[model samples]
Target: MIKTIIFDFGDVFLNLDKPATARELKKHEISNFSEAMLQKNREYEKGLMTSEEFVEEYCSSFPQLNSEVFTGSWNAILLDFPKHRLEFLKRLKREGKYTLILLSNTNDIHIDWVKENVEFFDEFKNCFDGFHLSQEINLRKPDAEIYEYVLAQHGVTPEETLFIDDTSENTKAAAELGIQVWNIDPAKEDVTDLFTIKKDLF
Candidate 1:
Protein backbone atom coordinates (compact mmCIF):
# COMPACT_ATOMS: atom_id res chain seq x y z
CA MET A 1 0.00 0.00 0.00
CA ILE A 2 2.93 2.33 -0.39
CA LYS A 3 1.57 5.50 -1.93
CA THR A 4 4.77 7.48 -2.05
CA ILE A 5 8.42 7.10 -3.03
CA ILE A 6 11.21 8.94 -1.24
CA PHE A 7 14.69 9.11 -2.69
CA ASP A 8 18.16 10.12 -1.61
CA PHE A 9 19.98 11.99 -4.33
CA GLY A 10 23.71 11.40 -3.94
CA ASP A 11 24.22 7.65 -3.96
CA VAL A 12 20.62 6.78 -4.82
CA PHE A 13 20.53 8.79 -8.02
CA LEU A 14 23.82 10.56 -8.79
CA ASN A 15 27.08 8.68 -8.32
CA LEU A 16 29.30 10.43 -5.78
CA ASP A 17 32.76 9.36 -4.81
CA LYS A 18 32.82 9.99 -1.08
CA PRO A 19 36.60 9.74 -0.95
CA ALA A 20 37.40 11.68 -4.06
CA THR A 21 37.07 15.19 -2.68
CA ALA A 22 38.86 14.38 0.53
CA ARG A 23 41.56 12.66 -1.48
CA GLU A 24 41.82 15.67 -3.74
CA LEU A 25 42.08 17.96 -0.75
CA LYS A 26 44.79 15.78 0.71
CA LYS A 27 47.03 16.90 -2.11
CA HIS A 28 46.38 20.44 -0.91
CA GLU A 29 47.07 19.38 2.75
CA ILE A 30 43.45 20.06 3.75
CA SER A 31 42.73 16.34 3.74
CA ASN A 32 42.98 15.61 7.44
CA PHE A 33 39.48 16.39 8.62
CA SER A 34 38.37 14.54 11.71
CA GLU A 35 34.98 12.95 12.32
CA ALA A 36 34.01 16.14 14.15
CA MET A 37 34.79 18.15 11.06
CA LEU A 38 32.58 15.84 9.03
CA GLN A 39 29.83 16.31 11.60
CA LYS A 40 30.17 20.08 11.23
CA ASN A 41 29.95 19.69 7.48
CA ARG A 42 26.68 17.82 7.96
CA GLU A 43 25.50 20.61 10.19
CA TYR A 44 26.04 23.00 7.30
CA GLU A 45 24.02 20.69 5.06
CA LYS A 46 21.30 20.72 7.68
CA GLY A 47 20.88 24.44 6.99
CA LEU A 48 22.79 25.41 10.11
CA MET A 49 25.30 27.47 8.12
CA THR A 50 25.78 29.20 4.81
CA SER A 51 28.15 28.02 2.05
CA GLU A 52 30.41 31.06 2.46
CA GLU A 53 30.58 30.45 6.19
CA PHE A 54 31.19 26.74 5.78
CA VAL A 55 34.02 27.28 3.32
CA GLU A 56 35.50 29.99 5.47
CA GLU A 57 35.48 27.72 8.48
CA TYR A 58 37.13 24.99 6.47
CA CYS A 59 39.71 27.44 5.17
CA SER A 60 40.44 28.68 8.66
CA SER A 61 41.15 25.12 9.72
CA PHE A 62 43.76 25.02 6.95
CA PRO A 63 44.93 28.52 6.21
CA GLN A 64 47.17 27.37 3.38
CA LEU A 65 44.29 27.02 0.92
CA ASN A 66 42.56 29.96 -0.71
CA SER A 67 38.78 30.25 -0.99
CA GLU A 68 38.90 28.99 -4.57
CA VAL A 69 40.78 25.84 -3.58
CA PHE A 70 38.36 25.28 -0.72
CA THR A 71 35.38 25.53 -3.01
CA GLY A 72 37.04 23.23 -5.56
CA SER A 73 37.86 20.77 -2.82
CA TRP A 74 34.28 20.87 -1.63
CA ASN A 75 32.88 20.31 -5.11
CA ALA A 76 35.12 17.34 -5.87
CA ILE A 77 32.76 15.20 -3.77
CA LEU A 78 30.13 15.46 -6.49
CA LEU A 79 32.03 13.53 -9.15
CA ASP A 80 29.36 12.86 -11.72
CA PHE A 81 25.64 12.65 -12.43
CA PRO A 82 24.30 10.28 -15.06
CA LYS A 83 21.66 11.05 -17.64
CA HIS A 84 19.97 7.66 -17.40
CA ARG A 85 18.83 8.32 -13.85
CA LEU A 86 17.42 11.66 -14.85
CA GLU A 87 15.47 10.00 -17.65
CA PHE A 88 14.24 7.26 -15.35
CA LEU A 89 13.06 9.65 -12.69
CA LYS A 90 11.45 11.80 -15.33
CA ARG A 91 9.55 8.75 -16.55
CA LEU A 92 8.36 8.01 -13.03
CA LYS A 93 7.15 11.57 -12.68
CA ARG A 94 5.33 11.34 -15.97
CA GLU A 95 3.73 8.02 -15.03
CA GLY A 96 2.46 9.53 -11.78
CA LYS A 97 2.84 6.22 -9.99
CA TYR A 98 3.22 7.71 -6.55
CA THR A 99 3.94 10.90 -4.69
CA LEU A 100 7.60 11.36 -5.54
CA ILE A 101 9.86 13.27 -3.20
CA LEU A 102 13.57 13.97 -3.02
CA LEU A 103 14.93 14.08 0.50
CA SER A 104 18.66 14.65 0.36
CA ASN A 105 21.33 15.93 2.75
CA THR A 106 22.90 18.51 0.46
CA ASN A 107 24.29 22.03 0.79
CA ASP A 108 24.40 25.26 -1.23
CA ILE A 109 27.83 24.89 -2.84
CA HIS A 110 27.06 21.44 -4.18
CA ILE A 111 23.54 22.46 -5.09
CA ASP A 112 24.80 25.47 -6.97
CA TRP A 113 27.25 23.20 -8.77
CA VAL A 114 24.38 20.89 -9.76
CA LYS A 115 22.31 23.72 -11.11
CA GLU A 116 25.20 24.86 -13.25
CA ASN A 117 26.05 21.39 -14.51
CA VAL A 118 22.76 19.60 -14.98
CA GLU A 119 20.47 20.73 -17.73
CA PHE A 120 17.61 18.80 -16.16
CA PHE A 121 17.89 20.18 -12.62
CA ASP A 122 14.91 22.50 -13.08
CA GLU A 123 12.89 19.70 -14.63
CA PHE A 124 14.01 17.30 -11.94
CA LYS A 125 12.65 19.62 -9.29
CA ASN A 126 9.28 19.43 -10.97
CA CYS A 127 9.32 15.62 -10.71
CA PHE A 128 9.02 15.62 -6.97
CA ASP A 129 5.93 16.35 -4.87
CA GLY A 130 8.35 17.91 -2.43
CA PHE A 131 12.04 18.44 -2.94
CA HIS A 132 13.43 18.80 0.55
CA LEU A 133 17.14 19.46 0.95
CA SER A 134 18.64 19.14 4.39
CA GLN A 135 20.33 22.50 3.97
CA GLU A 136 16.98 24.10 3.21
CA ILE A 137 15.08 22.21 5.92
CA ASN A 138 17.76 22.54 8.60
CA LEU A 139 17.30 18.82 9.09
CA ARG A 140 19.37 15.96 7.78
CA LYS A 141 18.65 12.27 7.24
CA PRO A 142 19.39 9.53 9.77
CA ASP A 143 17.69 11.98 12.11
CA ALA A 144 14.19 10.89 13.12
CA GLU A 145 12.92 14.45 13.11
CA ILE A 146 13.52 15.01 9.37
CA TYR A 147 11.63 11.85 8.48
CA GLU A 148 8.82 12.82 10.77
CA TYR A 149 8.77 16.28 9.27
CA VAL A 150 8.42 14.91 5.74
CA LEU A 151 5.70 12.48 6.80
CA ALA A 152 3.70 15.19 8.50
CA GLN A 153 4.22 17.68 5.72
CA HIS A 154 3.05 15.29 3.04
CA GLY A 155 0.31 13.66 5.12
CA VAL A 156 1.95 10.36 4.21
CA THR A 157 1.48 7.25 6.28
CA PRO A 158 4.76 5.62 7.21
CA GLU A 159 3.53 2.30 5.91
CA GLU A 160 2.50 3.97 2.72
CA THR A 161 5.98 5.25 1.94
CA LEU A 162 9.01 3.53 0.44
CA PHE A 163 12.41 5.18 0.78
CA ILE A 164 15.39 4.41 -1.40
CA ASP A 165 18.85 5.27 -0.22
CA ASP A 166 22.48 4.26 -0.68
CA THR A 167 23.22 4.27 3.01
CA SER A 168 22.03 1.40 5.19
CA GLU A 169 21.89 3.65 8.23
CA ASN A 170 19.68 6.07 6.36
CA THR A 171 17.34 3.30 5.21
CA LYS A 172 17.33 1.91 8.75
CA ALA A 173 16.18 5.28 10.07
CA ALA A 174 13.27 5.32 7.65
CA ALA A 175 12.48 1.69 8.47
CA GLU A 176 12.35 2.60 12.13
CA LEU A 177 9.50 4.96 11.29
CA GLY A 178 7.66 2.07 9.57
CA ILE A 179 8.55 2.99 6.05
CA GLN A 180 9.63 0.29 3.58
CA VAL A 181 13.08 1.01 2.17
CA TRP A 182 15.80 -0.16 -0.21
CA ASN A 183 19.51 0.39 0.36
CA ILE A 184 21.19 0.48 -2.99
CA ASP A 185 24.95 0.13 -3.49
CA PRO A 186 26.31 1.53 -6.70
CA ALA A 187 29.41 -0.64 -6.54
CA LYS A 188 27.25 -3.74 -6.17
CA GLU A 189 23.69 -3.16 -7.32
CA ASP A 190 22.47 -0.34 -9.51
CA VAL A 191 19.72 2.09 -8.63
CA THR A 192 17.68 0.32 -11.28
CA ASP A 193 17.57 -2.62 -8.92
CA LEU A 194 14.94 -0.64 -7.06
CA PHE A 195 12.63 -1.15 -10.01
CA THR A 196 13.16 -4.90 -9.85
CA ILE A 197 12.60 -4.97 -6.11
CA LYS A 198 9.44 -2.93 -6.35
CA LYS A 199 8.20 -4.37 -9.61
CA ASP A 200 4.91 -5.49 -8.14
CA LEU A 201 4.16 -2.07 -6.77
CA PHE A 202 4.81 -0.43 -10.08
Candidate 2:
Protein backbone atom coordinates (compact mmCIF):
# COMPACT_ATOMS: atom_id res chain seq x y z
CA MET A 1 0.00 0.00 0.00
CA ILE A 2 1.69 3.16 -1.18
CA LYS A 3 2.43 4.85 2.14
CA THR A 4 4.84 7.53 1.09
CA ILE A 5 4.71 10.26 -1.53
CA ILE A 6 8.06 11.89 -2.30
CA PHE A 7 8.21 15.05 -4.36
CA ASP A 8 11.20 16.72 -5.91
CA PHE A 9 11.54 20.36 -4.87
CA GLY A 10 12.80 22.21 -7.92
CA ASP A 11 10.74 21.95 -11.09
CA VAL A 12 8.17 20.11 -8.98
CA PHE A 13 7.29 21.89 -5.71
CA LEU A 14 8.89 25.08 -7.09
CA ASN A 15 9.87 26.41 -10.46
CA LEU A 16 13.46 26.12 -11.75
CA ASP A 17 14.72 27.35 -15.07
CA LYS A 18 17.74 25.21 -15.97
CA PRO A 19 18.80 27.59 -18.71
CA ALA A 20 18.59 30.71 -16.57
CA THR A 21 22.25 30.61 -15.52
CA ALA A 22 23.51 30.50 -19.09
CA ARG A 23 21.06 33.19 -20.07
CA GLU A 24 22.07 35.43 -17.19
CA LEU A 25 25.75 34.92 -18.01
CA LYS A 26 25.00 36.04 -21.54
CA LYS A 27 23.68 39.34 -20.26
CA HIS A 28 27.01 39.94 -18.52
CA GLU A 29 28.89 39.36 -21.79
CA ILE A 30 29.91 35.87 -20.63
CA SER A 31 29.18 34.24 -23.94
CA ASN A 32 31.15 31.08 -23.37
CA PHE A 33 30.14 29.17 -20.27
CA SER A 34 32.54 26.26 -20.54
CA GLU A 35 31.70 22.78 -19.34
CA ALA A 36 34.10 23.32 -16.43
CA MET A 37 32.02 26.28 -15.26
CA LEU A 38 28.90 24.12 -15.28
CA GLN A 39 30.74 21.43 -13.30
CA LYS A 40 31.62 24.00 -10.64
CA ASN A 41 27.92 24.83 -10.30
CA ARG A 42 27.03 21.14 -9.94
CA GLU A 43 29.71 20.69 -7.30
CA TYR A 44 28.09 23.52 -5.40
CA GLU A 45 24.75 21.74 -5.70
CA LYS A 46 26.33 18.60 -4.28
CA GLY A 47 27.49 20.61 -1.23
CA LEU A 48 31.14 20.19 -2.15
CA MET A 49 31.41 24.00 -2.21
CA THR A 50 29.64 26.94 -0.64
CA SER A 51 27.65 29.65 -2.45
CA GLU A 52 29.96 32.39 -1.21
CA GLU A 53 32.93 30.41 -2.47
CA PHE A 54 31.28 29.86 -5.84
CA VAL A 55 30.63 33.57 -6.23
CA GLU A 56 34.22 34.38 -5.32
CA GLU A 57 35.71 31.86 -7.74
CA TYR A 58 33.36 32.84 -10.57
CA CYS A 59 33.89 36.55 -10.03
CA SER A 60 37.65 36.07 -9.82
CA SER A 61 37.58 34.30 -13.16
CA PHE A 62 35.33 36.87 -14.81
CA PRO A 63 36.93 39.83 -12.98
CA GLN A 64 34.62 42.23 -14.83
CA LEU A 65 31.30 41.36 -13.16
CA ASN A 66 30.38 42.06 -9.58
CA SER A 67 30.29 38.96 -7.37
CA GLU A 68 26.97 39.98 -5.84
CA VAL A 69 25.49 40.29 -9.30
CA PHE A 70 26.86 36.87 -10.15
CA THR A 71 25.28 35.47 -7.02
CA GLY A 72 21.88 36.94 -7.91
CA SER A 73 22.20 35.81 -11.49
CA TRP A 74 23.11 32.28 -10.38
CA ASN A 75 19.97 32.36 -8.31
CA ALA A 76 17.77 33.67 -11.12
CA ILE A 77 16.69 30.12 -11.99
CA LEU A 78 14.62 30.07 -8.85
CA LEU A 79 11.42 31.82 -9.73
CA ASP A 80 8.29 31.62 -7.59
CA PHE A 81 6.75 28.76 -5.69
CA PRO A 82 3.06 29.11 -6.38
CA LYS A 83 0.62 29.12 -3.46
CA HIS A 84 -1.50 26.33 -4.94
CA ARG A 85 1.26 23.70 -4.76
CA LEU A 86 1.94 24.50 -1.13
CA GLU A 87 -1.78 24.27 -0.42
CA PHE A 88 -2.04 20.94 -2.19
CA LEU A 89 0.77 19.36 -0.20
CA LYS A 90 -0.61 20.83 3.00
CA ARG A 91 -3.99 19.31 2.24
CA LEU A 92 -2.41 15.89 1.75
CA LYS A 93 -0.56 16.29 5.03
CA ARG A 94 -3.79 17.15 6.82
CA GLU A 95 -5.45 14.07 5.40
CA GLY A 96 -2.75 11.91 7.05
CA LYS A 97 -3.15 9.34 4.33
CA TYR A 98 0.45 9.33 3.19
CA THR A 99 3.85 10.17 4.62
CA LEU A 100 4.68 13.29 2.64
CA ILE A 101 8.34 13.86 1.90
CA LEU A 102 10.27 16.47 -0.06
CA LEU A 103 13.45 15.32 -1.76
CA SER A 104 15.59 17.49 -3.96
CA ASN A 105 19.04 17.54 -5.50
CA THR A 106 19.78 21.16 -4.67
CA ASN A 107 22.40 23.44 -3.22
CA ASP A 108 23.23 26.09 -0.65
CA ILE A 109 22.78 29.12 -2.89
CA HIS A 110 19.36 28.11 -4.15
CA ILE A 111 18.30 27.16 -0.64
CA ASP A 112 19.47 30.53 0.65
CA TRP A 113 17.37 32.16 -2.04
CA VAL A 114 14.32 30.13 -1.02
CA LYS A 115 14.77 30.86 2.67
CA GLU A 116 14.94 34.56 1.84
CA ASN A 117 12.23 34.66 -0.83
CA VAL A 118 9.76 32.00 0.19
CA GLU A 119 8.17 33.36 3.34
CA PHE A 120 6.36 30.09 3.98
CA PHE A 121 9.52 28.01 4.27
CA ASP A 122 8.53 27.06 7.79
CA GLU A 123 5.03 26.09 6.71
CA PHE A 124 6.43 24.00 3.88
CA LYS A 125 8.92 22.34 6.21
CA ASN A 126 6.12 21.63 8.64
CA CYS A 127 4.28 19.69 5.96
CA PHE A 128 6.99 17.14 5.28
CA ASP A 129 8.02 14.51 7.78
CA GLY A 130 11.16 13.82 5.80
CA PHE A 131 12.90 16.53 3.85
CA HIS A 132 15.96 15.02 2.18
CA LEU A 133 18.34 17.41 0.45
CA SER A 134 21.15 16.15 -1.75
CA GLN A 135 23.68 18.61 -0.40
CA GLU A 136 23.07 17.82 3.26
CA ILE A 137 23.04 14.11 2.58
CA ASN A 138 26.08 14.26 0.29
CA LEU A 139 24.11 11.88 -1.89
CA ARG A 140 22.21 12.67 -5.06
CA LYS A 141 19.69 10.94 -7.29
CA PRO A 142 20.55 8.74 -10.30
CA ASP A 143 22.73 7.16 -7.64
CA ALA A 144 21.30 4.24 -5.68
CA GLU A 145 22.67 5.55 -2.38
CA ILE A 146 20.20 8.42 -2.15
CA TYR A 147 17.16 6.23 -2.75
CA GLU A 148 18.57 3.63 -0.42
CA TYR A 149 19.18 6.26 2.24
CA VAL A 150 15.62 7.55 2.03
CA LEU A 151 14.08 4.11 2.11
CA ALA A 152 16.27 3.09 5.02
CA GLN A 153 15.53 6.22 6.99
CA HIS A 154 11.77 6.01 6.47
CA GLY A 155 11.52 2.22 6.67
CA VAL A 156 9.63 2.42 3.43
CA THR A 157 9.41 -0.34 0.89
CA PRO A 158 10.20 0.73 -2.64
CA GLU A 159 7.03 -0.87 -3.94
CA GLU A 160 4.97 1.16 -1.53
CA THR A 161 6.27 4.64 -2.37
CA LEU A 162 5.40 7.02 -5.16
CA PHE A 163 8.13 9.40 -6.27
CA ILE A 164 7.37 12.42 -8.36
CA ASP A 165 10.08 14.45 -9.99
CA ASP A 166 10.44 16.88 -12.90
CA THR A 167 13.70 15.44 -14.12
CA SER A 168 13.42 12.35 -16.30
CA GLU A 169 16.74 10.88 -15.22
CA ASN A 170 15.91 11.21 -11.52
CA THR A 171 12.54 9.49 -11.84
CA LYS A 172 14.15 6.79 -13.89
CA ALA A 173 16.77 6.17 -11.22
CA ALA A 174 14.17 5.86 -8.46
CA ALA A 175 12.12 3.52 -10.61
CA GLU A 176 15.17 1.36 -11.15
CA LEU A 177 15.41 1.06 -7.39
CA GLY A 178 11.76 -0.21 -7.42
CA ILE A 179 9.97 2.97 -6.32
CA GLN A 180 7.09 3.91 -8.61
CA VAL A 181 7.90 7.27 -10.15
CA TRP A 182 6.35 9.94 -12.31
CA ASN A 183 8.55 12.02 -14.55
CA ILE A 184 6.25 14.99 -14.73
CA ASP A 185 6.46 17.92 -17.09
CA PRO A 186 5.40 21.00 -15.15
CA ALA A 187 4.82 22.96 -18.35
CA LYS A 188 2.53 20.11 -19.42
CA GLU A 189 0.79 19.26 -16.14
CA ASP A 190 0.09 20.57 -12.66
CA VAL A 191 -0.12 19.15 -9.12
CA THR A 192 -3.89 18.61 -9.22
CA ASP A 193 -3.42 16.27 -12.12
CA LEU A 194 -1.47 13.85 -9.91
CA PHE A 195 -4.26 13.63 -7.35
CA THR A 196 -6.79 13.05 -10.11
CA ILE A 197 -4.78 10.01 -11.23
CA LYS A 198 -3.90 8.78 -7.77
CA LYS A 199 -5.99 5.65 -8.10
CA ASP A 200 -3.68 4.38 -10.83
CA LEU A 201 -0.51 5.22 -8.93
CA PHE A 202 0.14 1.74 -7.61
Candidate 3:
Protein backbone atom coordinates (compact mmCIF):
# COMPACT_ATOMS: atom_id res chain seq x y z
CA MET A 1 0.00 0.00 0.00
CA ILE A 2 2.86 2.33 -0.52
CA LYS A 3 1.33 5.14 -2.55
CA THR A 4 4.09 7.67 -2.27
CA ILE A 5 7.81 7.55 -3.00
CA ILE A 6 9.89 10.36 -1.56
CA PHE A 7 13.36 10.72 -2.99
CA ASP A 8 16.46 12.61 -1.98
CA PHE A 9 17.98 14.56 -4.86
CA GLY A 10 21.70 14.06 -4.29
CA ASP A 11 23.36 10.66 -4.27
CA VAL A 12 20.01 8.89 -4.52
CA PHE A 13 19.26 10.06 -8.05
CA LEU A 14 21.82 12.66 -9.08
CA ASN A 15 25.37 11.47 -8.47
CA LEU A 16 27.36 13.33 -5.86
CA ASP A 17 30.95 13.13 -4.75
CA LYS A 18 30.21 13.28 -1.05
CA PRO A 19 33.77 14.08 0.00
CA ALA A 20 34.67 16.33 -2.89
CA THR A 21 33.84 19.54 -1.08
CA ALA A 22 36.09 18.76 1.85
CA ARG A 23 38.84 17.69 -0.50
CA GLU A 24 38.51 20.90 -2.49
CA LEU A 25 38.59 22.98 0.68
CA LYS A 26 41.72 21.20 1.85
CA LYS A 27 43.47 22.29 -1.33
CA HIS A 28 42.83 25.86 -0.24
CA GLU A 29 44.14 25.18 3.29
CA ILE A 30 40.58 25.43 4.69
CA SER A 31 40.28 22.12 6.46
CA ASN A 32 38.44 22.84 9.65
CA PHE A 33 34.63 23.06 9.76
CA SER A 34 34.14 24.65 13.14
CA GLU A 35 30.86 24.76 15.04
CA ALA A 36 30.03 28.28 13.80
CA MET A 37 30.68 27.34 10.21
CA LEU A 38 28.45 24.29 10.52
CA GLN A 39 25.76 26.45 12.08
CA LYS A 40 25.92 28.89 9.21
CA ASN A 41 25.54 26.01 6.76
CA ARG A 42 22.55 24.68 8.68
CA GLU A 43 20.97 28.11 8.62
CA TYR A 44 21.61 28.43 4.92
CA GLU A 45 20.10 25.02 4.23
CA LYS A 46 17.06 25.99 6.27
CA GLY A 47 16.66 29.13 4.12
CA LEU A 48 17.13 31.27 7.19
CA MET A 49 20.00 33.06 5.44
CA THR A 50 20.15 34.37 1.90
CA SER A 51 22.74 33.03 -0.56
CA GLU A 52 24.49 36.37 -0.56
CA GLU A 53 24.81 36.22 3.22
CA PHE A 54 26.01 32.64 3.18
CA VAL A 55 28.72 33.30 0.57
CA GLU A 56 29.72 36.55 2.19
CA GLU A 57 30.16 34.91 5.59
CA TYR A 58 32.50 32.31 4.17
CA CYS A 59 34.39 34.71 1.88
CA SER A 60 34.87 37.21 4.69
CA SER A 61 36.20 34.60 7.11
CA PHE A 62 38.59 33.17 4.53
CA PRO A 63 39.99 36.38 3.16
CA GLN A 64 42.33 34.50 0.88
CA LEU A 65 39.39 32.97 -1.02
CA ASN A 66 37.18 35.11 -3.19
CA SER A 67 33.48 34.45 -3.80
CA GLU A 68 34.02 32.57 -7.06
CA VAL A 69 36.71 30.26 -5.66
CA PHE A 70 34.77 29.59 -2.48
CA THR A 71 31.60 28.95 -4.45
CA GLY A 72 33.37 26.56 -6.78
CA SER A 73 34.91 24.67 -3.89
CA TRP A 74 31.58 24.46 -2.12
CA ASN A 75 29.89 23.17 -5.25
CA ALA A 76 32.51 20.55 -6.02
CA ILE A 77 30.45 17.81 -4.42
CA LEU A 78 27.75 17.94 -7.09
CA LEU A 79 28.47 15.55 -9.95
CA ASP A 80 26.62 14.27 -13.03
CA PHE A 81 23.02 13.13 -12.96
CA PRO A 82 22.85 9.86 -14.80
CA LYS A 83 20.48 9.76 -17.77
CA HIS A 84 19.26 6.29 -16.83
CA ARG A 85 17.95 7.61 -13.53
CA LEU A 86 16.00 10.30 -15.31
CA GLU A 87 14.58 7.69 -17.67
CA PHE A 88 13.66 5.47 -14.73
CA LEU A 89 11.93 8.33 -12.97
CA LYS A 90 10.04 9.30 -16.07
CA ARG A 91 8.86 5.74 -16.55
CA LEU A 92 7.73 5.57 -12.95
CA LYS A 93 5.79 8.78 -13.39
CA ARG A 94 4.18 7.54 -16.57
CA GLU A 95 3.02 4.41 -14.81
CA GLY A 96 1.02 6.53 -12.36
CA LYS A 97 1.39 3.87 -9.74
CA TYR A 98 2.52 6.16 -6.97
CA THR A 99 2.97 9.78 -6.06
CA LEU A 100 6.57 10.79 -6.58
CA ILE A 101 8.10 13.47 -4.38
CA LEU A 102 11.60 14.85 -4.20
CA LEU A 103 12.98 16.09 -0.92
CA SER A 104 16.52 17.36 -0.55
CA ASN A 105 18.60 19.28 1.93
CA THR A 106 20.13 21.63 -0.64
CA ASN A 107 21.19 25.25 -0.73
CA ASP A 108 20.89 27.98 -3.34
CA ILE A 109 24.42 27.73 -4.77
CA HIS A 110 24.39 23.97 -5.29
CA ILE A 111 20.93 24.20 -6.87
CA ASP A 112 22.17 26.90 -9.20
CA TRP A 113 25.06 24.67 -10.19
CA VAL A 114 22.71 21.77 -10.88
CA LYS A 115 20.47 23.91 -13.08
CA GLU A 116 23.41 25.18 -15.08
CA ASN A 117 25.25 21.87 -15.36
CA VAL A 118 22.53 19.27 -15.62
CA GLU A 119 20.98 19.58 -19.07
CA PHE A 120 17.78 17.77 -18.20
CA PHE A 121 17.40 19.13 -14.71
CA ASP A 122 14.01 20.67 -15.38
CA GLU A 123 12.72 17.66 -17.26
CA PHE A 124 13.77 15.35 -14.42
CA LYS A 125 12.17 17.72 -11.94
CA ASN A 126 8.88 17.67 -13.86
CA CYS A 127 8.42 14.02 -12.87
CA PHE A 128 7.92 14.77 -9.21
CA ASP A 129 4.46 15.43 -7.84
CA GLY A 130 5.98 17.52 -5.09
CA PHE A 131 9.47 18.93 -5.11
CA HIS A 132 10.53 20.05 -1.66
CA LEU A 133 13.89 21.71 -1.44
CA SER A 134 15.04 22.44 2.10
CA GLN A 135 15.91 26.03 1.29
CA GLU A 136 12.49 26.67 -0.24
CA ILE A 137 10.56 24.88 2.48
CA ASN A 138 12.69 26.27 5.30
CA LEU A 139 12.97 22.82 6.80
CA ARG A 140 15.51 20.00 6.48
CA LYS A 141 15.79 16.28 7.00
CA PRO A 142 16.91 14.68 10.29
CA ASP A 143 14.80 17.43 11.87
CA ALA A 144 11.49 15.51 12.14
CA GLU A 145 9.54 18.70 11.45
CA ILE A 146 10.34 18.61 7.76
CA TYR A 147 9.07 15.06 7.40
CA GLU A 148 5.96 16.03 9.30
CA TYR A 149 5.49 19.00 7.02
CA VAL A 150 5.72 16.93 3.84
CA LEU A 151 3.43 14.23 5.15
CA ALA A 152 0.95 16.82 6.34
CA GLN A 153 1.12 18.87 3.19
CA HIS A 154 0.57 15.94 0.88
CA GLY A 155 -1.89 14.06 3.08
CA VAL A 156 0.40 11.06 2.90
CA THR A 157 0.53 8.43 5.58
CA PRO A 158 4.04 7.70 6.80
CA GLU A 159 3.45 3.94 6.69
CA GLU A 160 2.35 4.16 3.08
CA THR A 161 5.35 6.15 1.84
CA LEU A 162 8.83 5.03 0.88
CA PHE A 163 11.70 7.45 1.30
CA ILE A 164 15.02 6.90 -0.41
CA ASP A 165 18.04 8.84 0.75
CA ASP A 166 21.80 8.32 0.56
CA THR A 167 22.24 9.70 4.06
CA SER A 168 21.58 7.33 6.94
CA GLU A 169 20.73 10.10 9.37
CA ASN A 170 18.00 11.37 7.07
CA THR A 171 16.52 7.92 6.44
CA LYS A 172 16.61 7.16 10.14
CA ALA A 173 14.53 10.19 10.95
CA ALA A 174 11.90 9.35 8.31
CA ALA A 175 11.79 5.72 9.42
CA GLU A 176 11.20 6.84 12.98
CA LEU A 177 8.12 8.61 11.69
CA GLY A 178 6.90 5.31 10.18
CA ILE A 179 7.98 5.90 6.61
CA GLN A 180 9.57 2.96 4.79
CA VAL A 181 13.14 3.86 3.83
CA TRP A 182 15.93 2.80 1.54
CA ASN A 183 19.19 4.17 2.89
CA ILE A 184 20.96 3.75 -0.41
CA ASP A 185 24.71 3.46 -0.85
CA PRO A 186 25.64 5.42 -3.94
CA ALA A 187 28.87 3.48 -4.52
CA LYS A 188 27.14 0.09 -4.83
CA GLU A 189 23.51 0.76 -5.73
CA ASP A 190 21.65 2.98 -8.14
CA VAL A 191 18.16 4.43 -7.91
CA THR A 192 17.35 3.24 -11.42
CA ASP A 193 17.10 -0.27 -9.98
CA LEU A 194 14.25 0.72 -7.72
CA PHE A 195 11.90 -2.04 -8.82
CA THR A 196 14.48 -4.83 -8.63
CA ILE A 197 16.05 -3.56 -5.41
CA LYS A 198 12.83 -2.95 -3.47
CA LYS A 199 10.61 -5.50 -5.15
CA ASP A 200 9.05 -6.53 -1.87
CA LEU A 201 7.76 -3.03 -1.26
CA PHE A 202 6.39 -2.67 -4.76
Best by lDDT: 3
36: Cα error in model 3, Å:
0.8
By TM-score, how accurate is candidate 1? 0.94
For 102-162, candidate 1 gives per-residue lDDT tens digits of 9998999999999998878898888899999999989988999999999999999998899
What is the C-alpha local distance difference test score of candidate 3?
A: 0.93
lDDT of 3 by residue, 1-202 (tens): 7899999999987788888989988888999988999999999999999999999999888888888998999999988888988999999999999999999999999999999999998998999999999999999989999999999989999999999999999999999999999999899999988888999997
- Expressed as tens digits, the lDDT of each residue in 11-113 for candidate 2 is 8878888899879988888878679988887787678887778888899889878878887788889998999989988889899999988889988878888
lDDT-better candidate, 2 vs 3: 3
lDDT of 1 at 2: 73
Every model's TM-score: 0.94, 0.93, 0.98
- TM-score ranking, high to low: 3, 1, 2
Task: Estimate the overall C-alpha local distance difference test score of candidate 2.
Answer: 0.86
Worst lDDT 10-window in candidate 1: 193-202
Query: What's the C-alpha lDDT at position 172 in model 2?
Result: 91
RMSD of 3: 0.8
Regions of candidate 3 where Cα sits further than 4 Å from its true position: none
